[model samples]
Target chain A: MHDSPDPGDRRDAVCVVGAGASGLTAVKNLLELGFQVDCYERETAVGGAWNWRHDRSPVYAGAHLISSRPLTEFPDFPMPDTWPDYPHHSQVLSYLERYAAHFRLGEHVWFGTEVVSAVPTGDGGWEVTTQSTGGGSSRTSRYAALVVANGHNWDPRRPTIPGEFRGRVMHSSAYKDPAVLRDRKVLVIGGGNTGCDLAVEAAQQARQVWHSTRRGYWYAPKYVLGRPADQVNDRLLKWRLPLRLRQWLYRRTVAMTTGDLTRFGLPEPDHQPYESHPIVNSQLPYYLGHGRITPVPDVTAFDGSAAELADGRRIEPDLVITATGYRPRFEFLAPELLDADEQGRPDLHLHTFARKHPTLAVIGLVQPDSGVFPLAHWQSVATARWLRLRLTDPARAAAVQQKESAKPLASWSKRRVVKTERHWFEVDHLDYLRSLESLLNEMEPA
Target chain B: MTAFDLLRFEDWTNPVPPADREVVSLLPEEDDGRPPLLFVPGLGHGAWAFAEHWLPHAAGRGFPAHALTPRPGGDLRAQVHDVVQTAASLPRQAVLIGHGVGALVVARALGRYPARAAVLAAPVLGGWSALGSALRANPGGTLPALVGGRLSLSARQLFQSGPPALTAEQITGYLSRLDPKPRAELLRRATPPRPVGDAPVLVIGSPDDRVVARPALDRAAAAYSGAPLMFPGMGHDLMLEASWAEPIDAILDWLTKQIK
Candidate 1:
């Protein structure tokens, strides 16, 4: 571990990594709170995951917001009412660009510049080294605070299958167009939202579409009662119903809307609805029922073009699309800064504040069931306020720090811990939002 | 692909069957001092059609809202009885809001049971005439929907001239939830009588609705001696459309005046 720097000698400049939704939000909030901000983005544009044109973006040609527009858009700057209940990926990118331009966040960001290393300085600040993608000279700068908003979707979590398949195999991140699956026998692994979406897409064009899942996931329709599902959930929060009742209602609603999953040969959900992130695709079940797509058990092994299922069924797939999801990686930061808990998640308070470094905060690291934009907005607000308080009022900063430290650290893990690497940072959207709101209230005092 | 050599542990847990109720309450059943509201969906739709936004908003406004899914394969009269019984079983005399065929059911139920005011959204008035108009507008869709035991209209037909913000995924999701209406129900000669009883009616219509013609909506409103609340350039699915709040706000305002 690097030696600690003196707290009194830090500068006032703040270094924000990535120019994605979280980064742009941090820049706007930090600037509003009178902090000198510098943001770095590896891509040429501001929209991160929404930027379908960006090489690193995991969004495919048919990508759209899983959550509804009202729930996903920034509360302060909402998407137009004329837009559909759910907007496409291109529209989401345009919205993000509009947000950046509206807040003048682009001026503070360095496009095509990647943060190579972010090391803690001896003076309670950060020394950030950057390298331009154009192969120019590397530059190093020092700032009093560090904000990691690089996002977690860049690193693809590829699943391993036994034996070797000679057919084409690709991760979902590399998938850009459905034309690739045209007339090919395609097999999609994983039953998350993306996997189900890709399977449905392939069903339209592929010769045959087969979806494999290890476990059952609660599937939800994007719209219920002519409104977005997330928006309905948000309104239901006002009812102040007990948690059990709420879960029961959610399960009943889902069952009625989606019908039976076992009827379509899909495994029934192992846990209750809202226990983990439910698959919000409505087409998967419809396609399965119509025989356009076949649901199979987990893959046991691969033998050339023939793939063996756990139930001993063999399928000859021409193409394999792995929609297994992504892993969170921060190669620029020291490994010691992110100490993992028993669940392999970093031991950060509220999944934002670094345990050892008071000035270091991470925004948009959480996986919420609702739209991530609002959560990112609230997180940036809290982090910016806390950083400002640390400089102006040491006593208040200490009090806030003490409050965070005294609270139970692994409360979420204790509630419902799923033994999957993908669910390491999974959080119930409503529960996480309440925590973020409470933290913001304490930091801003209003 | 190289990451596959590692031993992976499989966590197998028993799957739990979901609740078996067809009716879903958006808010708790406990009375919140406001009149309860029962929502009935149109042909080919389940209770989820209103579960997305209307039920929650109405619930938030102090009205405990509930949605009912009419059992599949029932005749029109039987389905109407199912809806009426659901409304009657509520904690108190509840306001009935219905869409399309559901509106027709509410109109008929008004004559059979005592209730508060009713809001008919895109009501199918002059039953045969409305059906003719729908057939003319969607000949390719109408015949297949009826014969196939399900109704499946394209997203464009459903949300005509409305916001084009819905992703393809959402459109498919929305379309997948459209259940099949029984052929016997469609052929049954059971149109509700015009202006059944003296209950105040608020008829909602959209000019851009391709599924139900504007003239039919006007006639439906005229039958009840009520003014048609027209939302220009909107689609047939008013509750799910982009300007959903417009009709909701109108209903709330009209409900306030009717209560007074």
Candidate 2:
């Protein structure tokens, strides 16, 4: 409740809004560039979505990386090769912890501190207000820039099924343990990664499991021929093979691995491969083949306790888990600053820089087919580089900004993924990373 | 990555898996604020080389000195990964000092880890340069090595100490500690990774070393954007000679300028 700016307020520092994977990387990169950074995390610790200890974390007990370690690790700080291809959630948390420790990122981070509000000061600086997560008077400070990395997966997006179900229903964010599904008839909705994962887990314990999806997805196995499939898949992507050839190869590979998912009584994909977010699940097919689970279409409506599907089928389930994805939420900054659409999803340049407010940017907003951390790393690197230019050479920075703002942001991939709420921030991992690398080259080539 | 880059890569599709590493250390009693020095050994060699003299000398001079050996398996990238990991495991940012095949590993590791500084001793760098030197030095030994056999080094092929203190018996004692059954490094054809992070480099080698020729030294130094600092009369095992303190002292002196 200061009538004037606090004596401690400083515009020389950059404020990073989270201490998760993206936030830690941002702080590290900024500090490496000699930028004074003050990172604030609402949680008591780091790891963001990967840390199940946080209330907003989505990681379940059995959560493991769908993206393999190589593509997932930071370009500079790679995961130890001794680790498995797909490390467990605990491994991811420790990795983030070690990264913070290695870079001394924790020194810059203010744990248990939440950014209350961020308002643009008239002179291209941010007046960021903060409060302790336990509730207290807000402390106001001024920062030259704000890097919002509060993650995109915590805010659950629930699908609105008509009518009310008497049975227990929960979002995938709330499905943290399999003990809840022990003998219950579980209907896992949405054929996304989370949905497929929950479905497979349910088959091991549930009395009967029904997987419901709006449309079929290309179920890529976690592994292909004893190697992590993401690494194997990148062979074609790295080769930059024509899309048709790549798709044919992917189809052949998937066909060989999982065979036709439709043969398991699941709906076939309506769109071409790469048109939807890939669902990596090797066990779904196995469970389906073993007759432990049933596949159904979208839930049309819920009548009493019965769930009616799009295909006129009815399933009475004890527990209905919605694996529908999440929407990005940035409450501290005003919506207009992000150039956000009606859905509150950001329209960031390369899923990072803000076109409208140059001082306001977001990192790790992207959902890449591969792992999200390395993309976050590169995004943080780009953000740091751009910020350095703004501080050292304002003229060149403004010129670059002008050009970037005028280019009319294009889809991250050559071919656009289906325009859906879930694909709001989806990107072709290779294509987007290549673009970021090229941009970095243009900015300050290594 | 271009096709040339792809060919140079072990496998862009299936990256060489990183391997385990064993590090031998000799720490100073007090921290002098100098960066740690990590010693990467030559092919068929282990950490025992640097652990013998350089590690103890560097530590005595108030630097955290350590030496690493790639756990006797995996490809060249794995070797590089082992070095990078060892550097990271050090207490502070490390000054990577690689000898022979390890110099090549350090060159590639520069593409990944950003060491504070680098030092290459009698580096096996350029493909043709290394091959030409190896064939000329001992064609009979080089023939079996090309087909994946260990290119065993003769006592003379390794040691050429000019100092009176370095007796022939002492040279053989040093060689005795080496892994006798170690495989020959045939990765001289590996693409030289571009020096990254702007770390200053020091290439110290001997023109008299029969294992690596002067051309290889020049190529390694130029690739890292540095000049070769020649120490004549020494052999490939720079740290195993009677003048072992010379190269480590030179490196320590360079660190004093570049670091503190």
Candidate 3:
């Protein structure tokens, strides 16, 4: 950890937005890195979506873990062995509470304080706009650096469908439990985990279900050889092999054991499999193998009681659910400050600091093939060191790095970055920890 | 009447309409010759709910009507206070008409205040009558949770949100003439206590109320020792349903004859 920030220098505070698993880790790292940090969360409690359930908000409707508990736990904390293979929503919340308490992060956090906006002051600092529900107060604060830790999923991406078929249509985000779907013939569009989960659950209640996907997608189970696929993949990614060979070997290994999409009713894809979805972690493939969920093709149109697929098959449905996906939205970020791709995901170099914005950094935006909690913690630690080096020993750091074969930590003002694909299939959690520690080590003055 | 019944009163306080200037002015200038009519709305409803339903009904009968909506804490005593406040503001005397949860409020008010008379239309009673009973029993204990959980899939609940379930045309017409206050103040009058005063009381029931349950409304009328007029096809939301005007006119005619 670097030298602690002067508590008296209130202006040196690093504001962490969101108190989710990622945000909490970021705050913990900032504290350990010797930076004064304050966390702002939109929810009244910690744990983000997990807290939504404990808070009993409707937003918690049907929350399931995309990543299993064993691989999902923080490095310092392990989940209780008594828990089932997959933890329930309540159990996940309990674990998040434990993580927060373990780090003593509650006092540093401002609950019910939503970060409405953050803009660069052009002086290498951030002006953060926040609304605090605790005392009905709205205020803006200046910070040395800002961490945008809010996760990018959960917001609904409305699908384009023909206007004629209107039974009762809502996004999967709006779906709570399947009780409201009793005796109804439902059509679930999208073969994503959410779509598949809803299809399987609804099949138990609804008279019939038609799950529509663009094409067949491979279903990877939560576990491989009695252990998590993530755990196995994590080890391979960290091995000392050529990046190209590793990518090829990773694909071959995944295909050998994971099997085909037919286990889930999806036909083989005609083209090479590249997921447009930033994150493709789901237990749907496992459910599909058990005949719990059925899959179909893309939807062409809907006419009242009937849905027409692109393949020319038509079926009657009493309800239609769109489990499409969510687009990344930086509603609170300044327009000029946003770095975005054609797909609307904020275009960030290394998926950390925005290419356009210097003092501003985004954490937990990547939907990693592995769990995000560990990645977010490492990113926060690297970021805290990056900020502290700029404030303290930039000249000495540049000279020391110029002498070493490995590149020195670049100044935030001069760093060049691009959006790198998250190599979840090849990542080891421990390898990532060591890599992040090395990056932090370089930032330290010799 | 049981001690529980004797302690209840009727509600006769009406709500302030929404911010619609046209509806505010549409209210006819107060007439000194006519007695005021106080309307108490049903559960999960506010004064705005009756803006179109009761507004025209009251106007057609040469009466000025106001609806009392539920507030955060709607119990029997709080309901009685609303009636007293409405009566003080309006003409000296007003006939109190409560429907569903509103009926319990009106009953509580009449037992406590000097109202002209009281009428409960399809008062929520029976095994499902836990709403009023729960409020009277535990005022501060998880009311939103109970109501939100139980009233899961009602038309009102669905339409209460964005774009509104009601037709856009209806909103443009009546929503402008509504006040948010009285409706904001009413709560679900959960159970019934008998009216304390010997005020004339009339209870109305419907055979088809899957939500309120017909047997529950029956027990309420039976407990009052009052004969309830039964409407075979009417459901819980009597005021908004078709053929409601006929039954409402019948009640008015009966009221006029009894008053004379």
Best by TM-score: 2
What would the per-residue lDDT of candidate 2 be over residues A1-446, giving only the tens digit for each residue?
Answer: 21334575776789999999999988887887778899999998999998989999999999999888777777666677778888999999988887787666777888899998999997889999999997998888999989999998899999999998999999999999999999999999988889999999999999999999887788888888778777777876667688889789889987776788788887778888888887888898899999998999889999998999898988899899999988888888788888888989777788788877778778888878878887887788788888888878888887777766665456355556877778877788777877777667656622
After best superposition, candidate 1 residue B63: deviation in angstroms? 47
Question: How would you order the candidates by TM-score, starting with the best?
Answer: 2, 1, 3
Q: Where in model 3 is the C-alpha error above 4 Å? A: A1-9, A54-63, A133-137, A235-265, A270-293, A396-438, B1-260
DockQ of 2: 0.27
What CAPRI grade goes to candidate 2? acceptable
Model 1 lDDT per residue over B1-260, tens place = 01110010010011111223378787644655566778888778888988988888887776788888877665555555566556545655567888987887777666544356789998864556555766766677667755664455657767754354566776688888776553544545554543322358889988778767877888778777767899887778888876777888888788878766
Share of native interface contacts recovered by each model: 0.00, 0.22, 0.00
DockQ of each: 0.01, 0.27, 0.00
Highest DockQ: which candidate? 2
lDDT of 3 at A267: 76
Worst 10 residues of 2 chain B by lDDT: B1-10
Instruction: Report the lDDT tens digits of candidate 3 across residue range B117-180.
Output: 6778877543234444434433444255454432222332112222213455543443343322
In order, candidate lDDTs are 0.75, 0.80, 0.60
| Higher-ranked by lDDT: 1 or 2 | 2
Candidate 1, residues A1-446: lDDT per residue as tens digits? 11222432336978899988999888977886778788889888999877887887999999888987656766445565456777999998887887777556787888898999988886679888888975788877788999999898978888888899989999999999999999999999988899999999999989999999998887888877666676666566655576688779887886777677888888887787767766788888788877999999999889987999999999999899999998778878876676664433576888888988988888999887777887787688788889988888888788888887887844433336355677667776656666666665566542
> Candidate 3 lDDT, tens digit per residue, A1-446?
22333332348789898888788878877776668888888777888756655332324345566565545655334455345655677777777786676456787887777788887878777888777653566677788788887766656777888748768888877778778778888888876667767877776677777778776554555566565554444455445455457446545755786566665567775433323222234445555566645677888888777788887988888788888766666767764575664555665544576555556778776554446675676677677767777678878545533543243223211212122322222233344444555655666555
Give per-model TM-scores: 0.61, 0.88, 0.53
TM-score of chain B of 1: 0.82
lDDT of 2 by residue, B1-260 (tens): 11111111123256666655678988899986778888888876888888878999999999888898867666676777777767665555678888987888887887777677888889877656666776887787667767878665666667774553477777677666666333344543556665544568899999888888877788777776678988888887888877788888998999889875
